[model samples]
Target: MDFGVAAEDEAFRVEARGWLGEHVGAVTERRAWERALGAGGWIGLGWGEGGYGNRTASLTQQVVWAEEYARAGAPPRCGHIGEKLLAPTLVAHGTAEQKARFLPPIAAGDELWCQGYSEPGAGSDLAGVRTRAVREGASYRITGQKIWTSLAHEADWCFVLARSEAGTRRHQGLSFLLVPMDQPGRIEVRPIRQMTGTSDFNEVFFDGAYARVEHVVGGEGNGWRVAMSLLGFERGVSTLAQQTGFAQELARVVRTARETGAVRDPVVRDGLVRLWAELRVMRWNALRTLGSTGDAGAPSVAKLLWGGWHQRLGELAVRVRGAAGGVGPVAWSASAPYEMDADQHLFLFSRADTIYGGSDEVQRTIIAERVLGLPLEPKGDMG
Candidate 1:
């Protein structure tokens, strides 16, 4: 529980800072950041050129990389699904051949990956997914629709959960398959623009998509386990990077408000104080989850708390920005775009924070039943 970094970790942090200073530059554009990651190995910092990462490095080292990258004004690596969720999952569950085929491009940022977990019918209730993949000779013909697929429109591949066996329990008979997005007659993707007017998420359609049997990660009927493992990583490590970025943005917002004299107002001061307190709590909570004594249930709680705070912070930013908070084109300046200002765009996007990954209500249910050992909520009959 020592929050202080060890001497070794300090050295690692110094080295990481030096490396980032040399290779990374301030890039406010998200696309430019992605390209920078590809050019540098910063995107998959600890990961090997192949599927493995520097296992010798402590978790503290990974945190160092994340923090230093953020300080350098580089977008955190979690912005891409390949580095955040898919790579680690692949390292754990992918076959040797599968790893050989996929890992390099992801490490190099030559390929992008997206998650095809949520559907029109199944989101928080992931086990209820109705997407089907029938076995056909040496391949599986996948046919289903996925929604909330972030970056699917630009992704080179997707890790999808499909019902490989029908008529079984919702959780059972599922498999995790890797489908190539460029393959013909197999996939269609349409962008789902948010209120922010940016299409970061998409609706992906799989029409008899052909995937080789070897494309399955882990194994058939083991998708539930693999997916659970992946979600654990998603909630833990992935969420850590995101919270770091949020905290950075929070700091930036505070500075902006102060410079603009918005902080002089009582209401603005109160909002900033509240946000600061919440940010501290979030950082501590996230550290606990990412630390050695981290618990499985901690992430569920962290996600819930962090997501709510993100939304609140965005609201506070909007209030601070006033008329400037409105979404529209902005005149270019040397600094960050006013249109891309934290309060407006972030506030709009925060609306979906609780909805994506897992809803706040869903996380609370998990904490209640699983963590607190409470009685399960009564289910409504669809029949």
Candidate 2:
């Protein structure tokens, strides 16, 4: 993989950086920034052809754009799930009609998407999903509960995996359906409050929620394959942008260490150096894997690397704060509850880093059974 950023790519970076620097904070400004990105034809880079602003962005150009966007401290992308995860899957496996209907809205920053994959019993073991979507005439009536659904309360649509054919087990007889979230009385979203006092995670229940027959991508009984493909997209170019955020967090930790005099501790200094070095390794590894063709195990490798790294960074954040790290919010009260500081939030949120988006154990299983060709773990039957 080439590490050098081309001159033209650098030029595009400068252009992107300038735009982001000019307009990227505040709700109104971020909305305008998104529209500007759409108007400037920068939203769908590397998605290929059909000109929803993805006409001819080379891989390097895409990387440069992501790196620049993160460096600018741009507002969290509202259209990311559609633009990154769902759009690419649609382009690859979706019907032409599906593409025409969805891609434009996503590219224009007009709609948002959230994943509807994880369920109560099927978080890491995706194939264990029990959501049922029964076909009736032109629509599928979906019924089941999904937990740990990120942004379910905010998403316009959700690409769901459900068991369409009954009596089939494991990875079989499933379908991928794009279900809308606006169905009154049919879909419910209950927010799951994180330790950071954020309600971003949600429990979503679908009771006869409907997805049109044509909205199913990759055909019937192919949900497993299609779902795995989308998971591959989870580890794509956006990871480079994520690294920039990680860098900022690390910088914060280092600054805290300096300010609190924790840097004087030899052990803390060594930990800081190690964190910096590991982050560099992560960035390089992410860049190296950018051009991959969605190999079955590559996503797991990326997950294993970054998940553990971020978890460690969270630990380092608390550690550098010395004894104060153990303390909660000031003016603690029973009625009001304690709010977490930035580092405290980081430490709390990062505890789940290894557990979500496929847990560390699940990642290890994929690498072992799929990548290393090891035997599958033995299954026990309670019956």
Which has the greatest TM-score? Answer: 2
TM-score of 2: 0.93
lDDT of 2 at 232: 77
lDDT of each: 0.76, 0.83
Model 2 per-residue lDDT tens digits across residues 1-383: 56889777777878877777776663365446566677777788978986554445888888888888888887777678888899989988988898999998888777788899988878877878889999999999999999998878878999999999988888889999999999999999999987677898899999999999999999989998998888778878888889988899999989988988888889888988998998898888877767777566777888888888888888878777654455432323567565657787788888899999889998999899988999999753211
Instruction: Return model 1's CA RMSD, one decimal.
Output: 4.0
Off by over 4 Å in 1: 26-40, 43-51, 54-56, 76-79, 291-294, 323-340, 379-383
lDDT of 1 at 249: 79
After TM-score superposition, what is the CA distance of residue 32 in candidate 2 from its true location, in Å?
Answer: 5.6
Q: Please report how far candidate 2 places residue 58 from its true position, in Å.
A: 1.3
RMSD of each: 4.0, 2.4
Top candidate (lDDT)? 2
